[model samples]
Target: MAEFSDYIVYVDESGDHSLTSIDPDFPVFSLSFCIVKKDDYTRAVVPSVQALKFKYWGHDAVVLHEHEIRKSKGDFTWLLTDRARRKEFYEDLNQIMVDAPITIIASVIDKLKLTARYPRPWNPYELALHFCMERLLMFLTSMGQQGKRVHVVFECRGKVEDAELELTFRRIVGGANQWGWVSRDFSVMEFEPKFAKKSVNSTGLQLADLTARPIAIKTLRPEQPNRAYDVILTKLGQIKEFP
Candidate 1:
């Protein structure tokens, strides 16, 4: 059995990776990896998110999904009735993010330019994953986590997608990437990927989910006033905007 690293990664994506029909408003796909040390995540981040949930919903079961929160749907319906409460909710959520000790590495891919440049463009999600994995290895190496197993948690997206993603992840770890550097030789870190349901309400996954869309919006419209992105920016360790 491999010794575990002190850190873990949670991944989430924003926007559809499909190129068949793109939404005019959003044409980019963004993938975010939220890396947090195990101790910090359990000691601080988990409590903070739970506190917020308890204060708002009286329970810790509600998942902090960006789309549902934005649309004031289901568990977030209270936001629709009270505007001041809505403002307060956002403020609280932003404070949690600002205080959390998370290292964010992301890839935002512009599908329009990608399709234009390559007659047969690669899947944006796979491309983003490749980029993120390379950076993740670099980060782990820098943190002196070589030869340790680091678990990466991802939201379950059904059987076929999960199987495909697992294959892609293994291939990347096997060194079939743009850099051509073997993971064992260069990175010296063993990656363990797991699929999780949102219902599990993992704090790391929820944070990653909140992170992805704000990044996509910022990349798509840099000049736009994005308070959420402003808060998220403070936590970003590295971000790549792909051509």
Candidate 2:
């Protein structure tokens, strides 16, 4: 089984709420979690990523669209599609998941629908990102209370143009101590954006993307129900209950 330790966790997001800023559509956001094992951080994450540099051209390496995976070879194709290969990959991944002790919490909002029901004070993207981060931090706190030290690293959402997103994230982290998301005297560090982008292309981010896609699709097809949530939850197998 994988073992836990003091590790660096990386995160990234996908999709935007620009078009929906006025008349909201689907406000989808993703949070990917990846951790570098204390002992094998360099070998496991850094080198593997460096090897994939040749394949980055003309492909959506970050978001990883399904169509592109269907056209690739080696790691990308095996990990993204090809069910048999994915099953084997997960079997191996179980060890890493247990050892590195990682989790990703992604939350999305169907903005057009949500605003129509209950309006929010901030932009949908900003609100959804903060909400997801809050839940993620809450989960981390609960894990820490169980005696785990987690160092969270996030890919900055570029230089935030919207002051609300900046303000909200600052407030959330600053007030974490007051809100019990952090212990009475614990400190959390945020890392630079590119560090997360350089992390391994693990299933965590792909799974988060999977979770967000259906929500985004549902905004246009209100008649359709989101089944990706259940599909991904089943695949992850660790998330028994979602908040």
Candidate 3:
């Protein structure tokens, strides 16, 4: 029996949900759960991230978004022209990831395989989320806290998708869906899963965003170099790959 901590998981996704426009180079849709103790995020992680942001942009209003940072666009535009600054900032960012007390649970959807398996496929995002929940249940069971509670924080996209996702989660957790009634040994999560929105100032969601792309890159190209994934490998709890 393992002791459990009061944890919250922040979920962020990478890659496209559209089946028609699937990029061959990156066909996988990925979701990453950036989990930390509730208080640790507020105490250590939040302050540390704010300091890092201030060091680069000199303002709290400026936030880190993965696409912008990856392409060096948006507030990161200067990174495109300044190789030295880009290198420095990336290194510092990597170090911050290394120091943060967090864990990642990743789910990857293989779009090519998914299409071949189904006449019409489930939403890739939902598929990945389901896989992550299975692992989350197992993780909690292993911790000897089959009755412990945990909350999940998701980034807000829009009302329609959000409402749909909430329904999906409830079905999954309540054994109203496939992942539930079928798996008797892992019947239910340690606790009934709770959810909340990612605050604008949330550093955990930002961390989750940073993790999503590198994981997509690594899953699509296992032979390729991926130092970003390496930084979190020790902290990665479970990585689920779906058809």
Best by lDDT: 1
Off by over 4 Å in 2: 1-7, 19-67, 70-101, 119-121, 145-151, 160-167, 176-231, 235-243
Instruction: Report the candidate with higher TM-score, 1 versus 3.
Output: 1
TM-score of 1: 0.96
Worst 10 residues of 2 by lDDT: 234-243
Candidate 2 lDDT over residue span 115-215, tens digit each? 56654434555555455555555555554532444445543344554345456555655554232234332234331123233245543343333344543
Candidate 1 structure lDDT = 0.91
Please identify which of the two predictions, 2 or 3, would achieve the higher TM-score against the true structure. Answer: 3
Model 3, range 49-77, lDDT digits (tens) per residue?
88888898898777678888878888899
lDDT of 1 by residue, 1-243 (tens): 679999999999999999899887899999999999999999999999999999998999899999999999989999999999999999999999999999999999999988888888888988899888888988889999988999999999999999999999988887776534444443488898999998898889999999999999999999999998998899888899877
Tell me the TM-score of model 3. 0.86
Clashes of each: 0, 2, 1
lDDT of each: 0.91, 0.43, 0.79
Worst 10 residues of 1 by lDDT: 178-187
Q: To one decimal, what is the Cα RMSD in angstroms of model 3 from the true structure? A: 3.4
